[model samples]
Target: MSEQRADVIGLGMIGGGVAVSLARRGRVPVVYDIRPDAADHLAGVPAPLASPAEVARASDVVLVAVVDADQARTVLSGEQGLLSGARPGLVVVLLSTVAVPVVRELAETCAKAGVELLDCGVTPGDKAAENGLVAILGGAESTVERATPVLADFAKRVVHCGPLGAGMATKIARNVITYGTWRAVHEASTLAEAAGVDPAKLLTVIDAADPEGATLLSWQRMRLAGKPETRAMVPQVERLLDKDLAAAQDLAGRVGVAVPLVDVARKHGKETLEIRVREDA
Candidate 1:
């Protein structure tokens, strides 16, 4: 690697991890966090900086992994933000999970200042600094190429999602799956425990049954192929889902347990799918 450094502006879970990973690879990243203790963990590994502007001044690619959209803006445009010292050719990668519009607006701001900004959403959280997370990138191809070296140091998989906000959009969609699955599993465990089955055992069975993950992937692939094709699979799939949901609802009612999401799924699942497929198509 060149003497030019990669910097991190946030030392939270994701940022801290990435800093450690970069230092482990001998990158010797310059990192800064609002919380003094957050950077304490990186001690000798990263060259700790006092502010985002200093980090931007010291590095070639600056990774912004702050909290939310507001924090992201603060770290990038606030008094001591990265933009204060950012220059042309500085690639600022946003790893925080914010809305698509925020990413686009930031990209424009970066452009106005002659800085290159890429929305690079990361998954697997803190473990990413060690086990390597997946990087979902959105920006011009040349910019993505320029950011590859830094990304490769901490990411196991790098996907160029599309222009500007696409990476954030994709990440938000993934968040939906993450939280929605959590809710579904919670309800499943509740129902299973109520019906005399061990929730852990149910999870084991589920894992065993879908070891390849094709169950969900198949639906995703179908939708990706377009609505006409997805529409064809819906009739049969919806029938099975409707029947199963009806039975599950009956079981829940008999056991005096409420599965409201299940009921909602039963009532609007197909419609939701139809709307999404059509809209995205």
Candidate 2:
């Protein structure tokens, strides 16, 4: 329905899902991929075009969802790449999770071609076709505004994180939270199993205590909120954390279980909890 034309390069899981979602929303985008059969597996998505340049020529906003930096580089700047056909005002939304430096390098490349680039980090690749992604964007405010409508066709929520590279940085940081929590869970389950407790029982207790895992982020929320009461409680909380972690370590030793995660958690508990004890205290 919108006047702006949208296109997608790379019809992999994320890109294919995006194209399908857009088509379902009546915004069917022009798409391209190196593999000729890329669109065969994606219903509602039209056949892939001959090249990225062709897609770019037909689009106002182009979403690049290629796998890695090298592929991204090839698609954007290689022979017959998008820049070859891009108009001066075209906007390119990069959806790859590359390093911040790589993002900046790509942005510079786009800028040289008189095209604007926005780094967009997306989540839940499995939910992409259902329009369930959260698009975390980093670019100028005007550039983001120009691409939001097209992005909205595939993403349920769009967050403009900050200037260029911030989206990739935020995505990287978010991944740490996810993978770190997984390691913590692994250690906990291993410890429980070694201590003659069923890991399933430990899971039950954790679920009952925090169904949505709100406690996993409670400390971050408190620190961000900067509540006076939270600040005042930090010292006591840090002390309790040390004691609890030390107990876990002792238990792990007695049960002959390795708890490296717990050990790291204890070593950096204060930093993780954002605790800064006052000199007077």
Predicted structure 2: clash tally: 0
- Every model's TM-score: 0.87, 0.95
Off by over 4 Å in 2: 275-281
Q: Give the TM-score of candidate 1.
A: 0.87
| Model 2: per-residue Cα lDDT over 1-281, one tens digit each | 67899989988889999999998999988899888988887877889999999999999999999999999999999999999999999999999899999999999999999999999999988888999999999999999998999999999999999999999999999999889989999999999899898999999999999999899888887777766677889889999999999999999999898888899889999887784434443
By lDDT, who's the top model here?
2
Model 1 root mean square deviation, Cα atoms: 3.3
User: Each model's C-alpha lDDT?
Assistant: 0.85, 0.91
What is the Å distance of residue 266 in model 2 from its true position?
A: 0.9
Q: RMSD for all candidates, in order, please.
A: 3.3, 2.7
The top-ranked prediction according to TM-score is 2
Q: Which stretches of candidate 1 lie over 4 Å from their true place?
A: 2-4, 225-234, 269-281
